[model samples]
Target: MNLTRPAGAVLLALALASVPVTAARATTAADEVNYVALGDSYASGTGAGNYSDALCTRSRNAYPALWAAANDPASFSFVACGGAKIPDVLDDQVSALDEDTTLVSLSIGGNDSGFASTMLSCQYSTLSACERALATAGEYVVNELPGELDGLYATVRAEAPDADVVVIGYPHLYKEGGLCLGGLSSAKRTAVNKGSDLLNETIAERAAAAGFAFADGRPAFAGHEICTGDAWISSSNVHPTAEGHASAYLPAFTAAVAGS
Candidate 1:
C-alpha cells in the first residue's frame, strides 16, 4: 500500500496555507469604558426631570446617565449643558474628553442653528414669522453648520483619538397627521418637523464624515410627537421627556455604540 495523500487534498492544503488569517479585534468590555457625554440640552436631558444640577439641567434620566447606569462604565463625565452651542462645547465640554475615553456621545448643533428660537417664534408669532425663522435656520444649517460641526468633531477626534464618538440627532416635534388643539397650526408643525429633518441630516452627514456613528431619534419618536396624545416631548420647551430619553434616546445611543 502506498502511503501518499490525494493530489486534490495536497492542492487544497497549499491553497489554505497561501491565504492570510487575520485575528478579529477584541471589543472593549463595558467595565473598561471611559465615556464622556458632551453637547446641548438634548444630551443634558433638560425636560427629562430628576435633575442632578440646576445650572446645566443635567438629568439623572438622561440617555448618557441611563447608559452609564446600565453599563457601569469605568468613568462617565456628563458635561452636556442645557443651552450649549458649538462654541460652548469647544470651550467647556470638550475638556472632558481625553486619550483614555473609550466612548463619547454628543447632541449638538441645534442651538447653533437657532432651532429653539425658531420653535419659539413658530409657537408665539405669526406663521410668516415662523416661516422666516425656519428659513434663517435652514440657511445656517446649510451654510454655516457644516464648518462648525467639522471644527468641533475635529477637536473631539484630537482629544479622544482612541474613542468611538456617537452623535445623536433630534426628533420631529409633532406628528404630522395627528389631531391637536390650538398649540401650533398644521403648517407650522410641518415646517418645524422639516427643520428637524434638515438638522438631523446635516448632523448625520457631518458625523459620518468624521468617522463617527450617528443615532437618529426620528424613527424612535414617530408616533410620540407633541401633537400625539402620548407625547415623548415635554410641553415646556419642546425637549424630550423622561420617557423620550429612556425609550427613544437611550436605545438609539445604545445601538449606535454597539455598532460602533
Candidate 2:
C-alpha cells in the first residue's frame, strides 16, 4: 500500500512520532539531577567563614556550595544545619528531598556520638581521663550510633529513592604521635584521633550496607590536621577551614557522586 502523502504532512507525522521519545529523555535527565546537601556542623560549613545564617552557619565556601558553583547543576538545596544530630536531620532536613532528587551529600554522626563534648572533656584532663572519655565515645559510636545512622539512611533512601547519597566522615584532629600546640596533651590527641577513626569506620560500613557512597576525609585532611602549621581544620579543633571544604571535602564528594 503506497499511498502518497503531501511532503508537509509526511514531515508532520515524523515530528509527532519523535515527540514522546524526546520528552522521555528530557524527563529522565531532569529527574536524575538536583544536588541536595544535608548533615551537621561540618556539612554546614560552620568554621568555613562566610555564614548564610547564624542558625545554620552554612558557609558559601562549603563543599556542597563549591561543588554547585563548579558543576552548575539545575538546582541546589543546602539544607545542612550546624549542630544537627541524626534525630534533627530526620525531623528537619528530609523535607528538602523528594523523588526527583538525584544527589545528596551528608556529614553527620559527629554530634550524634557527642564528638564536640568528647574533645572538650579531653582538654584539661590527664592521659588516663582522656582515654576513658575516648573509650566512652568509642562505645557509643560502635554500639548505638550505627543503628541511629542506619535509620536515618533508610529515611533518606525512602525520601529520595534514586538519589546518590554520599556520606562524609570526620577528619582526624591531630597527627598521631605528633607534637600538639593546643591544650590537648599528646595522649588526648591520640585518643581523639582513634575515636575519629572508629567513627569513620562505622560510617563507611553503614553507607556500604545502604548502597550509598562513602567520602573519606582522613587522607584528604592528612597533612592539614590541627597541630600541623597549615591545618585545614579550624582552631576550634572541630570544623574545617574554607580551604578544607573547597579542596578536600569537595573533591572527595565530587568523586563519589561522579563514580555513582
Q: Largest lDDT belongs to which candidate? A: 1
lDDT of 2 by residue, 132-229 (tens): 87888889999999999899999999999989999998888776675676547676777788888999999999999999999999998889888787
What value does the lDDT take at residue 260 in candidate 2? Answer: 81
The TM-score of predicted model 2 comes to 0.91
Worst 10 residues of 1 by lDDT: 21-30
The true-structure Cα RMSD of candidate 1 reads: 6.8
Runs of candidate 2 exceeding 4 Å displacement:
1-32
Highest-scoring model, TM-score: 2
Per-residue CA lDDT of model 1 for 124-209, tens digit only, reads 99999999999999999999999999999999999999999999999999878645686788888898999999999999999999
Alpha-carbon error at 6 in model 1, in Å? Answer: 42
| Pairs of residues clashing in candidate 1 | none
